[model samples]
Target: MTSADRSSDLSRAGRLRLAVAQLNPVLGDVTGNLELARRARAEAAGQGADLVLFSELFLSGYPPEDLVLKPAFVAACREALDTLAGETADGGPGVLVGLPWREGDKLHNAVALLDAGRVVGVRFKVDLPNYGEFDEKRVFQPGPLPGPLGFRGLRLGVPVCEDSWNDEVCECLAETGAEILLVPNGSPFHAGKPEVRLQVMVQRVVETDLPLVYCNQVGGQDELVFDGASFALQADRSLAFQMGEFCEEIAVSDWRRDGETWICESGPRVALPDTDSARWQACVLGFRDYVEKNRFPGVVLGLSGGIDSAVVAAMAVDALGAERVHCVMLPYRYTSDESLADAQGCVDALGLRYDIVSIAPAVEGFTECLGPLFAGTHAGVTEENLQSRARGTILMAISNKFGAMVATTGNKSEMSVGYATLYGDMNGGFNPIKDLYKTQVYRLAAWRNANRPEALKGPDGIVIPENIITKVPTAELRENQTDQDSLPEYDVLDDILECLVENEMSVGEIEARGHDRELIHRIEHLLYIAEYKRRQSAPGVKITRKNFGRDRRYPITNRFRDRS
Candidate 1:
């Protein structure tokens, strides 16, 4: 018989069951995350799984960043892994767990295979992704190319997260007499990443001629949200199982002898959400996890009755429930009756705790205090900034008193072009819409009104009123201070921002899109000059491929503009 037949014969039994553990691991919580692993292993055993696989760096959590530099943190992870390994001494299902492994001078992103209460094998990630939201190469030293590990009677080819992104790792395993491939991942979600990941695996299956299983983590880590849409593909490239996205789940798959290779007999298949629903789910999950993980009792935000604030309030209600969400209407002299009514309508619809706090006293106090310094200067943008500062101060005070986190509400458009006040409206613990463009804010607002997913905690149907959607967007800090007074209309502005921020197009190229040359130049200047402001903005969910913080990094002091 050939190697394929020999590989097949190594399986002690005719049947093998595999379990995918899609779990959320708290960063640097070695003890807690170890318990999570133990629980997942127990659940997999309950499902009659012979093997349980977890996502990458599950013990230390994904992208531990600078924490890996601390020797104590790395030692804690190893100690916890040893504890978990010792527990496997019971005849339960084996575990393939990912963690940071320190071998002498080199630290590796590795996964340990445990059975019969001890680690049987360990595999390290060969590929370290360094582009776009990933800085693995900066933290982890890549391991040598790997071959398959023997488990029970099967030769299992296991590649850690980024290793399977390319063809080399999978090809090496296939050539070295591996019968199957299983990949553990901490892949975060972008708009179209799920579909892209499936195609990448399809190519792997085609090249290796072996079945493959993918297990990804779920929940938010900082601004990155990992949607656990784990799946498996048979040798023929047929989907065997698909776990749901954005939730924790333990799904199992059965494999049967198909000639010299094993093929998955099939498992659960959850339909993936559409792009809009997926984006909505990502934002909610990210927002919820950030609040819960950081130990915030609840959240508070100033509800100006604009689309951005309205959308954030709804998200807050969905994420933490209406009881935890506090909406304060910080109205000034320019605050329209329509706006006040709209804000109240939102509070009533979402069942939120509502309060109307006039900023008249606070603004007047500031004006009086600064009157001497501003005696000769005309009343302009500086005074307009006072209104926002007053609102921010009030909301922050409320947060402090109630032990709630302040949730700022600023969309990508405002954030990209310095349309926000630094210590004023931009003052919050987090912003749910920080990465969402103005048009996307409008789009998701309408989408939320139309459909409420089962996953969200908030109530359904028209949570955002029609008037909020139809109203002209404004800051309401001054009389008739619509956003367009200083910027282009939202549709035009959003397109230009996307081109510059996401696409990184030049002004000439943006102008080629039929925009005026001067306008493109002006928007570019705004985008560049606003870097300092963005540096100080609150963290938010990253829905787009390139978000403001981790993905896009520009020099704040650079004078170079896109002259081309």
Candidate 2:
């Protein structure tokens, strides 16, 4: 008989049912998360799956950060995994899961292959990524490439997430005559990361000629969100079965031998969303999940009716329902009637719950408090910041009373420099549009208003009003306080930010790109000084190649300047 026929004989006893469990687990919630795993297993078994595989780090959640440093947390993970292992002993399907494993004095990021209520084998992660957004080396100790483990005469090779990124794991498994390669990942999202996965998988498939299945985790975890886009490739490096991105799904596909090779039976080949659209959707999902999963009742934000807040509010309503989103107009003495009416019109259009909370009293309260020191000083940007802070405090009070998360509406442009107020306008639990630049914010708002995707939870029709779109941007902190009063225009500002933050171009290089040297120096100065504020800022969706939280890690107290 051919190798294909021989491989087929191994699984010909009955249909080998397989299921993928995409879960949204909270960090450090071991008990609750294991229960979620149990429920998912039962559902998969009920659907006739012979083996159910959950995403990586489903036990205690991914990037547990300093929580992993706690011995008690690792102990809790062991207990949770053991409890789940025991549950599978009653003749249910096998389970493959990821968790933190403490072996003596070392902590390993491991995956357990369980069958008949016992963990038959364990594979520790071999590759620990230390670059951008990951600090695995700080927590996990790497292990050697894992060999195959036998189950009912079938040798299975399981790689924990990053293990498959290197060929050592796959070569060892193939050398050991492993029947299949299953990789469980806690991979976070970045534009076009899924395609990179496909490319890597295809290379492995051509080398080992083994049918590979890649399953990744999903949902927002603080600043990171794992888009669970699971897929399988045939031994011939051809796409076999694929799951949708940014969603949770359990799909079963048959694998049979074809003359010394394995091929997945007919299944879905889902197309991943484009970068721009995917980014928009990720922001919306992150916003929605962070609010709902954290048990926050709703969201509140200042509505200057500017493009940033307008887009953020629309995104908030789209994330949480219209009834759950709250818009407050914290108008100051300089606030124009046009802006007031525009804010109201936008809220009304979106069917959101809005209130007019004038910040005059609070602003005066601060002014009175600081009057002694400011007896004869001329009013300036400091006073403007105080006004912004007053509005921020009022929003926080409302949030405190109502148990709602304040969704700060600052865009990438404002966040790039020191345009945002630290304790004032930046007082929020999450920022939906944090990764998007000012120009992209306008484009997305227009796209969302025109084509309201059913997946979006906001009210249908134009959520962001036209007047808000066309109006000049302003903080409304002082009389005639247009954003241009303090910074460059949106188009120019976004380009500069893209260069300084994303491209990491020196001030001289940025100026060489046609921006004025004085402007570049001023922006660079602002950006460096604002590190302290950004350090204490709330976590938000990361939809760019270089998000502030994870991708960029500059010292808050640095005194270096790159002149060239």
TM-scores across all candidates? 0.97, 0.94
lDDT by residue for model 2 over 170-255, one digit each (tens)? 98899888877888888888778889999998888777878888988888887787888888888778888889888877776666
Among all windows of 10 consecutive residues in model 2, the one with the lowest summed lDDT is 1-10
Evaluated with lDDT, which candidate comes out highest? Answer: 1
C-alpha lDDT values of all predictions: 0.91, 0.82
- Stretch of 10 with least lDDT, candidate 1: 1-10
Q: Give the deviation of candidate 1 from the true structure as CA RMSD.
A: 2.7
RMSD of each: 2.7, 3.2
- Model 1, 1-564: lDDT tens digits are 433343354375668888899999999899999999999888888887888999999999988998998999999999998999899777677889988899889999999988767888999899999998999888889999998988777889998888888999999999998898999999999899999999999999999999999999999988999999999999999998999999999998899976778888869999999988898889899999999999999999999888999999999988889999988998889999999999989998999998889999999999999999989999999999999988889988998899999999999999999999988999999888898999998999999999988878999888999999998888877778888899999899999999998998888888899999888889899999999999999999999999999999999998888887
Score candidate 2 by lDDT.
0.82
For candidate 2, the per-residue lDDT at 438 reads 91
Stretches of candidate 2 exceeding 4 Å from the true structure: 1-15, 507-513
